[model samples]
Target: MKTQPATTQIGWLGIVLLLFLAACAAPPNSPTPSPVVPTQAPSPTPSPLPSPTPVARSLRLWVGEDAAALPAIQAVITNFTQASGTPITVIPKPPDALRLSVAGLSLSGEAPPDLIWADQEILAGLLADGYLQPVRASGDALPGLQTAATSQSQLWGIPITAQNQLLLLYNRSRISSPPTSSDDLITSSRAAQGGLVMVWDEPYWLVPWLYGFGGSLTAGADGPPSLNTPAMLAALNLFGELAVAAPAEVKTYRGGQRWFGEGEVGLMVDGEWALSEYRSLTETLDLGIAPLPRIPATNQAALPLISGSFLMFARDLSRDDLKPAEELAHYLEQPTTQIELALALGRLPASMEALADPRLQADPGRAAAANQARQAPGLPPTKAARCALFGIDVWLPSLLKGNLDQAETAEAMQAEAEACVTQ
Candidate 1:
């Protein structure tokens, strides 16, 4: 152990010398190596909150049972339902009876309807009763139509369909073209076996004649009814002349309808509402439509009262029902829907855009009616005024039947109208 070989001794001494040299060569300022640490897995991402689902909604709409307009309205409602998730229930009621029906429903504590599709005359009464709510609109409408739907300076209803006027319907087989003047109509009728026949006694039909002579039921909107005037006398004289010259029918509306259908008259004064019926009769009769004939004295076309139908929201809608009601109402007023409805019903459009449609432009009859409506005067919103105007029937039959003289007839007519408006 004490005596070792020279190589072994030298190797041991070399290892000791190398270890001392390495220790002396190391830098004093060098950083020590830290212990290795593992990274924790990333925290799982938190889940997001769920979004709310939309609730389904539905509404009931009341419409007059006008065969001419009901189908068009239904088609529009169908399209609206497809576009929106809401469903609509259309209830048909008699136009004249709608006011009564609404009063009954509302009084019975039943939800009357989200909307009432009544004409302006009916809307006037409903508005008076506080049964309608104002609509929010961002566009303009026909001035006369806007007037008809407005009450107390507020827009109470949205006019969906207009162009309801007393139009002159003729049998195209007898008349090649519509007569431009009442004189021409008289001459043409004299040539035919049966001449022009109209629902003359009804004030709804007679107002056009009154207008032609520059007479009106009321002086202006919210004004007292002015039934007796020089204009009224002139109009009555013309009425008498027509009754004597033309073949007058006794029962106004039904008689004119029946006679026209039976080919008893060459020309019939009717409304746009009768277009469908007359069109159907084309299988046997060639029917044509034109604006009322011109009056020579006044130099004015017989201006039928221009009015419109209202898409009114019921005043008693519940909070939840209002959303769908407003949506449907707004949808009904869209240009596309208005255009479609106007085209289908052959009614004039309230939308300026819809009025520009080429289809409407191409229809001469509709264009003529539209032109007349553009110039026609609007009636007052007073129900009494309407009643007074219609009273022309009561005394008219007696006058035509020779039971009263012209002076007495005028007196009686004036008295009846005055009494009505005063009431």
Candidate 2:
């Protein structure tokens, strides 16, 4: 059952790895950076790639970051513009919209944005469609992040932060310690003040429970439909059980946030992206962050979906158009810039050096976020995953509201997702 040789039967794997060196990570102190081919990127484009054309233009950056996070992000851009004296314009959009927007703009005859700061999950779709050019990063980013940003085993973007991770959060004022297992979480959530769990009624929040119990949205890891498994039913049942055990008073996400801050709800599930907001509540709320507790039946912790912001490039960038973007990207990767972002935004740095900096070491919350991230299976950015994630987001509410039972919900999800790929 051996596959053919590379020159004969090479699949997307070969093209993906061809974008950058096989050794994704570079030596910490390597004087020379790893070789990469932007034109040869992850897409299986025809050979005799066109030569680079010089274009004189300021870098256009489209960032998919929350409004509260823009200030810190802006500070970095300000430094880059000031240091390099390169004129740049910045625009912010929703993370989920960045990919679609970039793809649409490419087809409209308008030159694509020169740069993007977005979730790593969008890279696979972009690369699969030949919308992005691979980057020759310094390769000093955390191995976990490099892995997350890679699609089909190819590196397409440089990791900016290991920050988009879900973890169990509780208030020390209400509970002395965080729960380490599911049974404990249920008991503690019941005993906490207000006796209500601040739950996010969304699929992103349900992924860990599904994965922890061996349920999957896709068949095997290759992303075919297989949602109607016993494990999925069990996971859905577990989620319903927790929701029933602690009735929620707040109906909206913002309401839940308000309640959690007011100490009305002590336990919740949230991403590390919320660290800055929660860290500010130190005066009134003693927040504690921990990885999702292990399931007692399986003895496996829920698998967080790990991903982070990335610095990505447009496919059409000429050598001249790319210079400034590359300069800014490299500048963002520096230990100083990463450390500054870590402190100002309560984020986990992608740079190993910045992550180990003494200043960042003092923040226990960041450490907990990193621990949870380490336990994640990472957000798969494949085309199949992109399709499945959409179906998951669409079906989560029906399952949570009890409009669809576990079996019914799983079947609907499978059918809907299979339809997505087929169409």
Candidate 3:
């Protein structure tokens, strides 16, 4: 209510200014205004990133002594690795020693070979023991194989090579005309000045006659324990005649190549692999290859013992591990590889495509060997059957020893075989 002076108003304004300054200098513990955060477009739900691609792996392989075919094998592995982005390693093992080593490994269950190139007889034993895995022919890995080779009914091993013992190798210079029949062969053998050089003591060498005479060492669809037939007796008689006619060294002849290579024998029944060694001896020596002659009475094609097969074996491998093994096996069975092996090793290729290879068609020796293999029949599946007449390992040496008479030996052999079949 009292009238104040201008100076008094000015003082009041100054006091208000001081109070504003004090409020602006408030304590540090006081709450402050927070910054405004912009909302992110809900991170586009990361499309579940696709999983990384699986990397391809490498494969390991075991091989047998086909030294001549090594280049082809290496090329195949290299090409396959390049194409599939995979890798392969091959270990070479001798054929003869392979079976023993594999057996020992399986027995110990330690570091068994991933694959084996084994004799067919040895494969048979291994298959019986469940040491191998059967494979089908139709697959991306080995598209070149014919279904016949991988037929499901008789799956045991993949036949990489087909070797038979019924090939009749003649010195083309000595024998102007090759015989077409067994009787002619017999007559020709007797007429030869140096005498014929068939593998007299080798059981496999005798297989053609066993079949030609309509004798089956193993039982057919009929049943078991029936090998002592009249046909077998006739085969035995013919064998005995040939044995008597052969040279004294025939008893001592360790191998067909030894006798044939020496040129002491005019005609020899042996495997095709012998051609190389024989050729080395005398390139000028005319070499002729022919199938075993048909028997006089029976015109049926004779059965020859098959040699060996390639089998896959991996200890405790999963399906993934088996994939490469199967693929490599298939690659080996391809027409190119098979044909090359046949040409190089003088062995028959398993696949029909290989049989029809142009390279083989161009070679007379290869063609003859292939033809002989196609015409020859396979041996009976049983061990007893093979041991009795096919000249399996045990009976072969005993038969060659010549200690027992034909009758006695046949009886003993038959008894052992029959016992085996019964068991």
Which 10-residue span in candidate 1 carries the lowest summed lDDT? 243-252
Give lDDT per model, in order: 0.76, 0.75, 0.62
Candidate 3, residue 258: how far the Cα is off, in Å: 5.3
When sorted by TM-score, best at the front, the candidate numbers are 1, 3, 2
Candidate 1 residues 1-423, lDDT tens each?
588999999999999999999988867777889999999999999989888876675688889747766887888898888888788888888899888888897477866788888888788888877888887654456676776776556787787877768888888777788888978877776675447677666677777878888887776666656666777677777776666545544455677687777677777778876777878876556887888899998898888888887788888777887787778778877777787888887788876666777888788667767777666776656665575575676787776677886667767877887777666
- C-alpha root-mean-square deviation, each candidate: 10.9, 30.6, 6.8
| lDDT measured at residue 45 in model 2 versus the true structure, 0 to 100 | 65
For candidate 3, write residues 1-423 as lDDT tens digits. Answer: 999999999999999999999899867796678999999777656688899988765555666655666676567668877766667776676766666667787577756666665555556566556666776554222111122122224455566766544577787777777777877777877775435776666667665777678776666522354446677666666777666547665554455456666666667776766666667777545677776676767876554644534555544556877777677667776777676667666666776666777777676666765665654555433455545653332454464457655565566667766676656
Q: lDDT order of candidates, best first?
A: 1, 2, 3
Better of 2 and 3 by lDDT: 2
Q: Which model scores highest in TM-score? A: 1
Best model number under lDDT: 1
The deviation in Å at residue 16 for candidate 2 is: 99
